[model samples]
Target: MCLLAMSNSLLQSAKKVILTEAQAVMMLADGLDQSFIDACQLIQNCTGKVVLIGMGKSGHIAGKIAATFASTGTPAFAVHPGEAGHGDLGMITQEDVVIAISYSGESDEIMTLIPIIKRLGILIIGMTKNVNSSIGRISNVHLDVSVEKEACPHNLAPTSSTTVALVMGDTLAISLLINKGFSVDDFARSHPSGTLGRRLLTLVSTIMKIGDDIPIVSADTKLLDALLIMSQKTLGMVLITNNNNILKGIFTDGDLRRVLETYPNIQSLTISKVMTPNCQSISKDRPAMAAVQMMDEFNLNSLPVVDDNNQVVGAINTHTLMQAKII
Candidate 1:
């Protein structure tokens, strides 16, 4: 009974936190200002890199924002304000744009670097809640990210304010991305190690079974022989090719089942007699995601991959696509 009561209390607390965060997000959405546009314009017009600076939790969010900008076509990097006072300030050039993040706009670490940054002639964009604070007053462009209260019960932690800052940063990055005509292919190039890259950049040639691994049989081959080859390849299907090695049709598991039901004596039938004549085929250079879509639209589990001359080059199955995370 004690454990059950504890669990109930924890669940209730979690729900309250979620509701508070939702309310805070709504407040941010309602308080959009022109200062946001000014900040974006400054960054967009910057001739050099974007330098993001912040302290504590704001610093972590600023780092993520800098990474997003760099990956999405805008060249940017995060520099700790405290380190800027040492020697890291050299990373900033006169043509660069600096973005400083602080909830109260009076973080001592960030304040100490402002004069040096200004003396360097670098453009300054301030992201803060207080418009009259030191950083805001000195900045060329000020973006307001004020929040009514934090999601934290004591209102001491940077919860809602950090969320607002992150959203604002994402908005700026995406706006610049669109303005620069960043494409899906460009994103794929930036993320080559993840599932997104595999889905967008992986070609049929990379995943399809080629040469000896492909289950192929001549049109005159018996259905039983084709089934044996299909079983050996473990692809659940076999392709029917002409004497010129060109794809003519496909004999899949479904076709075998239908043939068995329609003609119980199909064991002795020729493969060409029962195969699907108008089977879907894809090019070797087609994107893996496109192949998955074609299979889904045609209600097929496998497809024959062909070359420019319509010759059967390879075959791919749903399992292969699943392993590659293309579906």
Candidate 2:
């Protein structure tokens, strides 16, 4: 009975904390106004990077906000207010915009660098509870991230306030992302090691099988010979081309099944008689993701990679895409 009561009490406390933080986020959303717009425009117009600064708990949130901004097409980085006072202040330039995060609006370390930042004529965007606070009063634009109360029972820890500030930072970064018309391809270029990067940046030429690796048979080849080549290639399909390597058609396992059922004497038939003529092919220069889409839309297991003159240069299949993780 004692343990049960303690568990219930802990659950109630956890529930209260989540509800309080959620309400704080809703309040932040409802309070959005022109200050948000002004700050976004200021950062967008900046020719140099965005410099984020804060102290203590706000400093941690500032680093996360900086990372979010940098990944989402905005050039941004965080500078510890304490470190900035030492020498990191030199990183900021006249063309850069500084976003200062301090829930109380008066961090001594952050305040110390305000004079130097102002001297360089760099714009300052302040996020705080009150517009009239020290940091707010000196800021070119002030974003109010005030919350009704912290989720902490004593209202001492930086719980709700920090959540609100991080949300505000995300809102700003995403708004800039859309306003600048940043694309998935552009985002992929910045993150080459991520999954999206591999899908978008990987060209079909890099993944497609070339030369003997591609299962190819001349149009005059018998259906039995084509099946042998497909079995050896293990790509589930074979490409049919002319003597000059000009693509003519494609023969897949599915086509083989249908041909077996339709023709009683399949051994005597040429590959051209049962193969899919004028098959949908892709250029090797296209992104591998495009090949995935094309194969999915056409219900194709493999595709012939053609050159400018419709000559077979390579071949790609669902298996290759899966190997490359482009699927």
Candidate 3:
């Protein structure tokens, strides 16, 4: 075949797969009912985590679903059905809820473990394409993830079915997340090193440049001296303050540029003469994200941090926020 023809075939195949999977997800959404609500309530009422079990491709989907549940305020983890025969069933108990995943709802290994879970008096939630299959018959709640066809051209692979299963799992997890009122801070706690955690949990004092690195100068300091300090600190701005360390105004590189353009003798100017008064400042205890918002609102790159007395204690800029991953 020619290159153009082969490329056309590949593109068409990809588009068909996407369209099939999209249909599958829509069907899964439409099929949600009181059973889904009951499943969510069962998982929510469990004192322990949701122990998911499956075989083969369903096992892969089950693992991902377990991870989604765990990250979204619903505690869950996946266990292999075959492994349950090898004594992994001990991981589950009456306080936990078991979520069994199987397209046909008749995976032999899963069926074998169903009795064991039932013996423990554990509630079982079945996710499958067949509502009349063995797992569905025994489960306390049955969620239908059925799809009309597979995305695979041969209709033999677990393609559209898996997509539907994942979406259904997401629906359950997110519903529980909303019911529990999970906040950004709670999510951030689970991922302290991620950008969201840095934005939501990082405090201004943690990232603000402190000590002598802060660009500070007296209001009476000459423009040449202030410029030297700003350059030495490499902050592109200087805090113009009185001898008592109380902030009088702020003089940035932009302020210096304007002064240089407006005045004939830049060297003769004092920082107070060209500084911007009543500049926006934040307290040390505020979240670093708040500073990002201020900078965005005022089109500023730096902000002075002050104590209760309005004394400049530290300074932060866009670069600092970036370093902290707060932007």
Candidate 4:
């Protein structure tokens, strides 16, 4: 019974923390004003990269914000305030825009580099709770990221404050992303290894089986002979084409199962007699993801790749999409 009580108490604490942080984020959203707009303008008009700087826990949030900006179209990177005081300050150029995050708005390390940043004529955008604080006062634009209280039971620990700062960073990045008319293709280019990149950038032609790898048989070929090719190709389907390689029909394992129940002597039958005529086919120029969607929509496991004139070029199956990580 005591164990159950402890478990309930732990859950209550977790729920309370989540609710408190959520409410703080809502308050931050309601408080958005021209300062947010001015900071965004400073970043959008900058000729160089966006530099993010913070101390301690704020530094961790700064790194994440920098990554979000870089992935979404803006060029940005995080620099530790302590490091900037040492020689990393050189990383910031006059064309670059600096976004300094200090919840207290008085990080000594960041303050130490302010004069040098100013001397370089770089623009500063500060994110903090107090506009009158030292870092905020020096900023060209000050974004208020204040919260009523921390979610921590002791009213300390950077809980709600950090969440508000992170959300503000996201708000800034997405706003800039929309303002610049960034497209999915652009985001994919920045993330070539991600699932979105694979779906958008990978072409069917690149992953489809070509040449002799495709299980192709003539219309006149025996059904058993086509089965041998299907086994060798391991694509679970075979394409029936004419002498000119123009696709005439397709035969899948499902067709073979139905054929077995209908025909007593399937070995002597021609593939054209049992093949699915006018079956769905994809163009080589289409995205690989399009092929996956077509397969799902038609309840198919494999699809043939053809050219503009419907001449067979390649083939793909569930295995192909799986190997390419498009599914």
- Ten-residue stretch with the least lDDT total in model 4: 191-200
Q: Write the per-residue lDDT of candidate 2 for residues 1-327, one digit (tens) a residue.
A: 699999999999999999999999999999999999999999999999999998999999999999999989999999998888788888888999999999999889999999999999999999999999999999999999999999999999999999999999999999999999998888887889878789889999999999889898998898888889999999899898888899898989998889878998876999989889989999999999989999989988889999999999999888899999998
| Best model per lDDT | 4
Error of 3 at 91 (Å): 0.7
Q: Model 3: residues >4 Å from true position, as ranges?
A: 193-201, 324-327
Residue range 1-327, candidate 3, lDDT tens digits: 999999999999899999999988887778789999999899899999999888999899999999989988888999998888998888887899999999999999999888778988999999988889999999899999889999998999999998888888888999999999998778877777767667889999999989999999887899899999999998889998888899888989888779878999887888888999999999999989889899999999899999999999999999898887777
Ranking by lDDT: 4, 2, 3, 1
lDDT of 3: 0.90
- TM-score per prediction, in order, is 0.90, 0.88, 0.91, 0.88
Clashing residue pairs, candidate 4?
Answer: none
Which candidate model has the greater TM-score, 1 or 2? Answer: 1
Count of clashes in candidate 3: 0
Distance from true position, residue 239, model 1, in Å?
A: 1.4
Off by over 4 Å in 1: 194-199, 322-327
Q: Flag clash pairs in model 2.
A: none
- List the candidate 4 regions with Cα displacement exceeding 4 Å: 193-202, 220-222, 258-270, 285-287, 325-327
lDDT of 2: 0.93
Model 1 CA lDDT for position 194: 74
Quantify all predictions' global Cα lDDT against the true fold. 0.89, 0.93, 0.90, 0.94
Tell me the tens digit of each residue's lDDT in model 1 across 1-327: 699999999899899877877776677667777876777788888899999999999999999999999999889999998888899988989999999999899999999998888888888888899878998899888888888788788999888889889988898999899988999889888888777777889999899999999999999999999999999998989999998889999999988889988996876799999999968999999888889889989999999999888899999999888887787
